[model samples]
Target: MMQCYGKSRVLTPTVVAAAAFALNKNRSLRTQSEEVGALDSWKKLWDTGMTRWHQRDVYWVLQKYGDDYIHKESRVLVPLCGKTVDLAYLTTKAKEVIGVEGVLQAVKEFMQENPNLQMEAVGSRNGFDCFRGEKIWLLCGNFFHFGPAVAGKFDVIWDRAAMVAINPSDREEYVQVLGSVLKPGGVLLLSGYVRPKGDVKSGPPFTLNKDQVLHLFEHQPWVASVECIESVNDAFSNEAWYKRLILRWRFGGVVSEDIWAIHSKAK
Candidate 1:
């Protein structure tokens, strides 16, 4: 991602290499023109699409979990939250909710929509300002920056679309960060799409099968038990598709770990 830090834009090594490859598309301007087009496409379409998707609601998860999810005033953490409706869910049950987002556009829109929310930009290490209200706050920064010092702490971490949104190569990092941010006995209501548009070989809409999803959190010692809630079947282009897995991880993983959601429920 090309990020604007100070006066100039900083490109991660992956971004730079990707840009190089994109530039080689056309014989005329070749790689250079391709890179510009690719980046423009990402900013205009792909990234914007992500922001919009997250901004929608999470009523599906809420209906499933119901009130047992948490009580009023419980603190919750939403990582790479984007401009999501889950914040609304959090505010109702929890006293405060902290949301993290990398893109600037999404955060800006969120702040505007929730005008009652107060914001104070933080220093470099923690990323953006603190948007404080009776129940909402957003730390518009990278997902990896959760942990104790930055976010203080939280009793629940809701990870709906975040894990799959990350590159497969970065799954471990994502798990490590989640473990660090969540409390020892905290709960994680995780949800994500699977078998999403098979053509999505390159994406933020990456999908994961049951085996792969389990593998992500298995190595982490802090997580207790990983259990599946449900699977959503979706249809795309006349192809029957499997979209999501709703999971629960408790006390870092609950002592009597019971997993294997797909084998038991998914057909």
Candidate 2:
């Protein structure tokens, strides 16, 4: 059997528990050893820095159609959603947002930004801080730990800094796991830089080739629409300056193939 855990000592019971829960729901993952380690490292390095990826314009871009496409009181799931500014957009559009981030620091910072939020500590595989807002509740924990108790149907998924987070191998599993949360017909908007292998050195802050991305989700029966918006930036570093593609994928939940496809024709 392949060793499931990485060499990082930071892997704790909380992390493993989250992994176990996620594993129980889905059986596909394409992550490499170093990539997983970098993700673990990236979570530890989070701070309230303005340069954080969550602060980028992608948040608003992802939510642009929300006013027309999404409904109120609809639950939205954000996986690997670390202090994602995108969560702010979902506030008025949806009833609750369950942001599954591996880091507690990001959750704390998110609470700090929204001081009016009444937050309560909750326990799970890796721990979670649930923020209750008048219209939104930001649940902090790894998405994997999001128990089956989260049964309400979500209208859309805001996947901003999520899919770009893992190594290339793991991207497929990321989609399936994330896709599992939304109710049929939910819209999924994913925006992030796709680093070609030549450019990226260190990342969570990582990379994904366009083809690999599309192949992961191309076949989902429920995907009604797919649109890709490509952008170029020096945000992380010039060496890794990339033309990113934002994939706006819609799931009608009508798939014979449980495996979701990127529907690149949206490009």
Candidate 3:
């Protein structure tokens, strides 16, 4: 069984073995062409309906843990957000919800699909197409190019699948971009899958385990702490899209999904 750590927990070899045997196989299934940092690749994926990463509902992790940090007065930012329903859900919790996406098609689809939200074009800013609803703002442009100057700082950043999707080489730059817009004393809720040891490779959904997350953020001067709040074995096994990808990838191995709550130090 997967462990949920309110404080901290150790990962045993048995746990990894069990996860491998379960549905955690082939966690990093996207091809090199789908590298998310590349704007053209994301546009291609959205144009061709290869958006398996796009979840139909609000992410379960966010639903379960988000309330702890997100408040009615909080301003939330979702980076590299790809037409996720999570934005709609976030609009209810935070005073404002901002989603930065690279693909215009995905932005248009999000507006089209959530017509009930009444989101409409609000002109462009800094070259990004802007769409606004009551409490949600969707920016269609390069996420790396976006900063606090465009929309101001955020109290919380929800990074589900966003960090892991970037090429490992660009991770530092990605972190810088996220940190630049996050307010002092802000919280970042990050979720991603960890691959088995010694399997370093380029990936769209890269292997970003708990340890890497700690090393990436904990050492930063602005970061206060990085905590693994939740973890699950074979978390995506039941997803229909995961099942379909496994048949083609056939890269069986142990993979564990982890959710980290990284807090920025108060200035």
Candidate 4:
């Protein structure tokens, strides 16, 4: 069992907005624009104690799928992991766990939350501070700077809130980096939101439509297929609907060849 991060506190919308404004000058409204989106906005949210997105327990989607696909001794990677309790939960099940977070403060809070676990600075790589232990490794740096060489490859990838929380412009790069570290035939479990048509512009919790999800991985040779799609409830997407997208990577794939063969037969 892992140590709990204590109870969660509720914050008002006005307070959250005020903090965003006072803390980050780049973003004026609730969230940042895709092009001008800054990581400093998230850092401000963490420093100001406005992290309402943090969950009290394990995420519902993970609770539903982890046991079925993520087996014992499986290596797991959680990106942009901001003091997420899910990291600790994974440590209980997986042989090795790696968490990459852009904010240094979030990693510090996570270590403070788990006093029982021992953590030490392993070294610096790709301009990020890396910490390692027997079961877990936490890297404090830009998530994009991390790759297979920095963090090694993993069997499973968990995106509890990472994908939805990032800027739209960065989404493609995010997926690319994720694929680079994932082993062949690895599984990617994602939790995202589908909001009303206009709500996509209003986000740090960006709304992701089914078409967008499909299009994101449509031509990727690494993605074998989307295995499952399901609906669930989440605090961030309460007004909307939360969706889970499970993608399985191909092992020694020839997807391009298959596509070419089909097209040739049509001529």
Candidate 5:
């Protein structure tokens, strides 16, 4: 059964039991060899059409929570964005939406898929191909190389798959990079997956519990507060693609989808 927990509630036993089952089953799944943070690996995924993470429409989390932070004057940044239709949706609410992607293939696909957007090649910067639309800019290059200097600070950041897609060791650096581009008082809407207490390690879509997220941002001077707004236990049940991936990977265990609202301290 699907369960959604609010900020005031603690994790239930059902969630824990499901996670245990998932981790035990995942232990038998095939080991993944791809380096998740490597640009080449992402390029290969785009080349081979292995992007199961790509959703056709705006993500539900964004649809439900976006209006609270996004406004007509807001400048939003989306990291590790992979041809998501959400970028187009964000432009409707914000003044400008900038997406940083490592793979040119993915960026090209986004442009191709949204012809009505009318994006044009603006040129290149720091080896990144830049595409400009009415209220959107796609930067095709290394996400780590992007900073506030490249495009100024953003009022909001939408991180749906960026955090979980990288290695755990790189989390601190990821947080630092995110902090560098966010304006004071800006908000980050992060969506991630969490499993029960276990050591099963295969990933591109890694597990990151609420505690880990808090610890990562706790010591950061720019951070004001980190709050878990929602948690859904049966996160992928309704998505046929997620089910197919789970079956193909022999993954067992309850994975919960968590939404975090991380706020930057005001200046």
Candidate 6:
């Protein structure tokens, strides 16, 4: 395991209980070790290459709707950015791009792969290890530790899978943190997955329905509006049970959608 500057603590009961519930839905049980450690569990997933969620290229959301909303020379923020190649892509269009990641291994791998980045360590800020370059800044630490003072304001926030990956218990605070860093009238490009009410447990790729999305945004005063630009009923996995459930729940089947909503932070 890669050494993290920050200490790893046992997962809180709330988070463990949530994880256990999700695990139970899949008919699996977590060992005592897995139950106690949140960071280690995620670190193990990345270390073992279990990161199927990691996209090879920039997300479809950016390809499709980014140009429409994100202006050239804008400052863009990517939350929970897992060394996705999208960071490099963003640098081409944006004047500056900031990415926040929790894992040290992901940060190291990203820097190692992208040799073009003229990176220099900027030391720590609010507990995050910070690095800066010509067009990019990579912060390695817990995303929750990032504050407006540390992260500064941004004109664009590319929230691909970050929201869904968070534990439900922390979502409201997560949303608040997001709102704080965004400059007023900034663009927030968001996307995630949703599914029919099934026997399956909740997930890191958590189910986020349209209504839930609306509710989440509306509650935040900074969010001016949420226009769900696209939605489609789609397949989840190749599992036999998953396929059958899609057919059974035809009216409200499982699906993943790209949300290209334009959020204007309150002026």
What TM-score quantifies how close candidate 2 is to the native fold? 0.64
Model 4 CA lDDT for position 60: 61
The segments of candidate 6 whose C-alpha lies over 4 angstroms from its true place after superposition are 1-36, 198-201, 235-254
Q: TM-score per candidate, in order?
A: 0.66, 0.64, 0.84, 0.73, 0.84, 0.76
lDDT of model 1 at residue 88?
A: 66
Report the C-alpha lDDT of model 5 over 175-223, residue by residue, as the tens digit: 8778888898999899888754553275767887767887787666677
Ranking by lDDT: 5, 3, 6, 4, 1, 2
lDDT of each: 0.55, 0.51, 0.78, 0.64, 0.78, 0.70
Stretches off by above 4 angstroms in model 4 are 1-37, 233-267
Q: How high a TM-score does candidate 5 get?
A: 0.84
Clash-forming residue pairs, model 5: 22-252, 22-253
Q: How far out, in Å, is residue 6 in model 6?
A: 45
lDDT of 6 by residue, 1-267 (tens): 122113322121222222322111223233445334766777898898777667666766688767987777799999999889999999988989999998878888888888898777889987889988769999987676576778788999998888888765666667767777788778678875775664223676676666666656665656666666666445344435446764437526555554646476444
Off by over 4 Å in 5: 1-37, 196-200, 245-249
**Clashing residue pairs for model 3:** none
- Quality of model 4 by C-alpha lDDT: 0.64
Give per-residue CA lDDT, model 1, range 1-267, as digits (tens).
121112211112222221231111122322455435533543475354633344344545665564666677567888877677678667877778888876666676777776655554544445455655656777755555455777676777777667767667767756666666666567777765555334325455566555566676543455455556555443121221211222112111111111121111111
Total backbone clashes of model 6? Answer: 0
Better of 1 and 2 by TM-score: 1
TM-score, cand. 4: 0.73
lDDT of 2 by residue, 54-83 (tens): 554334454544575557757777777776
Q: Write the per-residue lDDT of candidate 4 for residues 159-247, one digit (tens) a residue.
A: 87688788777687677677677777677777666544335564656776555666665445455555334543223333111222221
RMSD for all candidates, in order, please: 14.9, 13.0, 9.6, 15.8, 9.4, 12.1
Backbone clash count, each prediction separately: 14, 14, 0, 0, 2, 0
